[model samples]
Target: MSTAGSPSTVDAPRTAAGSAGSDAPAPPPAPRRRTGGVLWTELRRGVGPWCGGVVVVVCWVAMYSKTPQWQGRWTETTDMLRSVALLLCGPLAVAAGCWQGGRERRRSTGDLLASLARTPLRRALLAVAPAALWPPAGYLVAAAGCTLATWPYAGEGRPFLSHTAADAMALAALGVLGFVAGRLIHWRLTAPLLAAVTYVGLGIPAYSESPARWLSPAYQHTYFWDRPVWWFGPASMVWTAGLAGVALLGLAARRRVVALLPLTVACAAAVVLTHTGDGLWRPDPATARLVCDDGTPQVCVTAVDRKLLPSVSAALSGVNARLRGVPGAPDRWIDGPRTPSPGREQLEAAPGAIVRRVGEPVLLGPREAQLPSPFGLAERGRVSDPVLYANWAVSYLFSRNCPGSGVDTPAARRAAAVNDAVNQWLAPRPYAVPAPLPGDEVHLRRLHGMGPAESRAYLARYLAADLCRPDEVPVP
Candidate 1:
């Protein structure tokens, strides 16, 4: 007989016969929230404090360190932006699941929840909602922060990251993926270890020339570079859809047979998509430029030069050889003008030779980046070319304030001046010329084709041949 004021059969008191509490507040009326109903509530309850803490900590550290500039620009470059997503989201997701998973148990409400035709899995899903939600939320926070940070640094008329929409979706998908993976393996020891492994694994490809970056569950947003994976947007929608199907089936399955198919197929597809063309596709150079046509933006290749192509090939070969000598060096590359290195002594000693670098960006303040030479020579040069008016300007500035590099004596300084004049006369405008033309004007062409050791020897030999004298070459 059902009584008007009695608890339902499933939710009845768990006593042997007549154990009763007269004033238990009616067991809070079954919580009014079902197993799946507390999604947003749990998400907010779980991730709110942690997100607040993260913002506070990141802001404090960044401010404390004075927020060092990256490559002479603000530290909001493309690679660092991607890192923001990874660092903030990946951990939040997994932690959210484990932290909130046992909420009911912690509050002594587990028995009541278990009686609602719910499995451990359904309740686990509720617990992990915060975990899933936090990563995406973190992405949004990071993206918004980056936009504000980069706004002041925009070039010409190009808006800051025209493809901001694509990037946001991509980050959200990756965060969701990470949160789900964490919820699945909620082991105390394994969760953190798995999170770390996933973090590193996803990062390797995103920074590489490979397409594996698109498949990574950690990339939330991408700059408007012409990477093929960006064409699919950041959400990795196909993969995320498949993952959702798997998660839903995983929730419903009661036995091994019922669970195997969707998961196995989904996982296999993921693996294939991630590793499809590991060593195959090569992105063309000149693809890094941003493009715009009637509000339709795309990443497109701009120009190609075949002149002195051998030098480009030789530079790449040298890089590969260096990587072979050093373990764990990144050997792959996207062919382009190399960005100038900062804060290091010149890696190559040939002063007249243009140092060619691929895939690096030209940054501000190149003069301060110069390193002290091994010899007591005070190395000095600011203009891109040291063989023309730029050379003369640098030479005049150096001789006035500092002794010339490689010039041990006053006579050597005089001789060094002679060398500079001849170099300027012969090369005319070394700074204005592109790398290909710059190297050819100063017999730096001979510097190529030779191996590193041989190239050093040739630079010495070329310096000895002074076809022109200082008195004959007038100061500009």
Candidate 2:
């Protein structure tokens, strides 16, 4: 039945074999695809480089712009970085996650992708990996930048990597939750709504007075002398991971009841970890211990303020010399109290110790100007002008300046008059002479008339009197 050019059956087989052998070596069997290559390609195509870039940029800007305030300590630097991550990066992660989750729906590829052999949960994990990983990676990059920036200025402390790690985990969990939300809802506004809700949720705990505020990750600011417990970071990670797990299960798993187990266990562990009286952090001995100077009438500062030890020591030396033989004279100068307070420096007195906080101004000033003495009458818990002025006079001998006790009572006026007269007698400068109050004339006259010897005797008497008992403080 074949034509002459078509040839017979034996010739047809030979021709087919020749054609098959000649067809580009069968295209090399299509190069055998690998799982890693596919996953990587999916990650690159889905998230895009800009997503990670934006995260890194935001984190860098947030941390670097505020570098001046947080550069003094590793704890402060890391704390600020964590705060920025919560406030800024957390929301960004949510939006990015939502965007990533909606990719299939946006491209109308959901049905096509569903037809693939991979299970839904596995596919979801692969898709969610980029969102979950990039945010934490961005946080770590920012943390590392902050750590490096703080290294030159930071003192006496190591970076708390556990805190940063917990923060990274929390952010990743939030991203996963957002991805799940996007998968379930398929709304365009979900990203912004989730962001708003997250910000509000974080803000509520920060502003609230209840102990339950501890549930918020943003509430974990490190106290000045304290460090978080070892378990606290892990507890936060587990709790957040549980939340993310529950959300993932809701989106990807077939059984909802079984999914709650991880959340329940996580909540229980979080409760147990945070239930201790120490709260999230405890005083760190290394950062809180007294760092003393080498000299008589020992000068000591908390380890965090070791840089100020020299100035504090020099300031206390003159006062200590003046009070060498006096009763009730402080034998030690300590930096503030054992507790932490924000922005306020208090000077306190114990039996033989005088504790005064070294503020920023003092730390930045010259050695001679950093006088943090405990000689003000208010410092001794006395409110009377005469007692205050007498204490001021003793302090003036060491400080060469008015105490400016900020008391405006009649007694204070009289004390000021006496102080001016004494200052005039001692220095004879062209300064404004304060007019003596009616009863203050005698004290002023006596103070103005004292010679060096009489002044020494007067100072001894003033120093010996009990300023705490205002009635017993003798007025010269």
Candidate 3:
């Protein structure tokens, strides 16, 4: 006999008689298969993620390959690689997390899996398993693919070496953030929104005038290159840790809805609590401290090693002399070339004068640096350091034989005219040529104006200088 709806004796399995039983407890039902291996199985099912990884890698290869910078020394190419990685890979990781999380939730598998005997921690990890492994795998594949693509084109040091060690670590952190996001948000709508918000928050301010803006992920100074700011190391760790914590907490709450509300509230509260009323992050005083060369320049004009020191010195000297020749030159001083060790190469100068490499100039100075804006005439040419500007000035002085010769020919003039028209349409601030034509060589030499050496140097260093300004900083 059995209670209503319960299995009756006839339907139930009959126990063996006492003699067959031998007091052995019925095998305990195989202990209900452990859920530990779920993480492994889930991770194995990340083929879509792998394919996505492949797509990202392909894009990086294609894009970076097309950049003019990729054609030169392995060193520059590697920096570009790292910059592209930092700029692109982070968002991709977040996207991976969102996709995997949404799929699991949409399938209703998360609820089913969570109902199993597995501990919540194991369950959370299992749910995030795909994101955890795949994004990093994607980053690794992207990085490796870039290195491989660049290998045949490399002239010196392994192209991979040109990429900084920090990139790998940053990518790993990106992956973890993605994985954590997957575990926390199960809804399709919320997952992507959350990821986007996080990404925007991390990147928006690195370009801000405030030094604390360095807290922004985009502020990872010297993106592909190197910049030494010990402050960023700890800040990055803290931020990553905080994000990881929030992600885990969101996963472990009693209910998903309840878990989510707090994150929004916390973010709101932080905004209120930290608000300075100003539109920018607070500047750190240390930011003003000029990192000096003191014989060991990390990124300044004097940063060049002894082997290349002579060349760098010669370039600086030439620039100073040329500028002095200007009728009303600003006061000039060639501070010993100094820079932070392990920084993107640049020529530092006092505020009024732009200091840059002759062969390669840095583009970090204010707009005033490009004084007399030579518009609708020569396009931005091989202008790097002040020395290079001198070189360019001299070169331009020589390029023309007379007012209508060389680049002054009818075709050249027509091209310039067309370019000037196009520039009018594209420029945020349209400008007209100051003179009907660029000055002749004689005029340029006499005026100490923009020269040929400057053009050549600009051509060589153009990419580096252009890339130096933190993204979205609007070339200052």
Candidate 4:
């Protein structure tokens, strides 16, 4: 065994394995370059990339136009992109697809393409790929850019990827339909007319308060904190993709009967979409939950907006300072849609009234952010005019369920003027405060002359009295 030039057991086994492995046949090389060449030809030669470029440009511009509204929030970002996909890119994609579809007919090459070895389905898919896929690619790019932009400022929650996927499917479906239309009709004006009709058609259903509006991918959403039902995105995808599949199959498949399956699926999806309606959305507990900052007269916003809490707190800092130790001040200023709503009549009243909001603020003199609606937030991201809005919010709190809602009589006017003066003296406006009607100057001077503790005491008494009855209001 140990004879001269004899191999050891380990070396012998290793050599044998190496020889065996080397003798085995190699795998076929992948046709990567060929596949790439075909794709390059399709993208480079066709109208697909051009259509995609148009989408990129339009979506980028639209997103930047309203950057402040959506940049700091994931929900806003996703919804904004969804709107762009449906309204602008969608129509353009349809027109482009139709134009692309007519190319083979214009060149008289339909017969040539058919004569090729590829199956009808393969040819159809290959031909339709450029038109249908490009718009979604453009959208994907825009979506990525938007998400990256929002990353720095976003407060909470991930982007609604399902919404984005559904939106892309919708664009592709529209493009597919337009392609089929072009194949059937060769008129040049047909594209423009389809675009116009489709645009109008999308809008017409929106005016009707029916569930059909929900079937459109462009339907509006009001709340950022609400999430779609788990199946909504999948349902939307199925509905659109199914319709597209049916259209493509009807146009190119050898057997037209194959279209029936997709047609049936689309119908079922459409039914589900129609029946669900607004019920598709529900409050996301994580986003809707209160996130409060620790401060006397604490400030709170939804957990989804936690990052913006500091800004909100800063906005109300001056007002909070005034109300922190006051005997009749609200313990916290809560901002959210879920803030308990006042009954109808009380909700409608004017400022300087004894209104109870979320308890213990007997005097509405100092509450802030009673209504944290997205409309208001969108108008001013991070509350652009915090001092002014803070002042306004405080004034709004005292407005509920009081006879002071109307200043019909001269006495009521005087009471309102005094209330205005007290509000101004408590929270100074950034700009010159307008003198209240019927002269609040005298009361304002009296309050300005008092020490801080004494002034707070007088404010307590004044707020307790019925400001609507001039006789009952304390002379500061």
Top-TM-score structure, candidate number:
4
List the pairs of residues colliding in candidate 4.
Answer: 350-399, 351-399
Pairs in clash, predicted candidate 2: none
Q: Please report, in order, the local distance difference test score of every candidate based on alpha carbons.
A: 0.40, 0.65, 0.43, 0.76
Report the lDDT of model 3 for residue 455.
34
| Predicted model with the maximum lDDT | 4
Residues 22-71, model 4: lDDT tens digits: 89789898865464566667877688998888888889999998876788
**Which regions of candidate 4 fall more than 4 Å away from where they truly are?**
1-40, 204-208, 339-383, 401-407, 415-423, 428-451, 466-476
TM-scores vs. true structure, each candidate: 0.46, 0.68, 0.47, 0.79
Which regions of candidate 1 fall more than 4 Å away from where they truly are?
Answer: 1-37, 47-49, 52-78, 102-110, 117-124, 156-191, 203-214, 217-230, 234-237, 240-353, 357-476
lDDT tens digits by residue: candidate 3, 1-476: 46997757765555445435777666655554545565567777764367346546754775465544453334444545555655565666566666665665567676786677767765666666566556546655666665675555332233433123445445545555665666456555655565577567656765565645534444433222223333333434444434544565566645555545545654553443225222222323222233222321111321211222233334435433434333332232222222332222445433323333232222332211221111111111211243333333233211211232233445455434332322221121212334334323233233234355653343233222322122311111
Model 2 stretches with alpha carbons more than 4 Å out = 1-28, 45-48, 295-298, 307-332, 340-408, 412-476
Which stretches of model 3 miss by more than 4 angstroms? 1-37, 55-59, 66-83, 144-187, 191-199, 223-238, 253-476
TM-score, prediction 3: 0.47
Which candidate order results from sorting by lDDT in descending order?
Answer: 4, 2, 3, 1
Ten contiguous residues with the weakest lDDT in model 2: 375-384
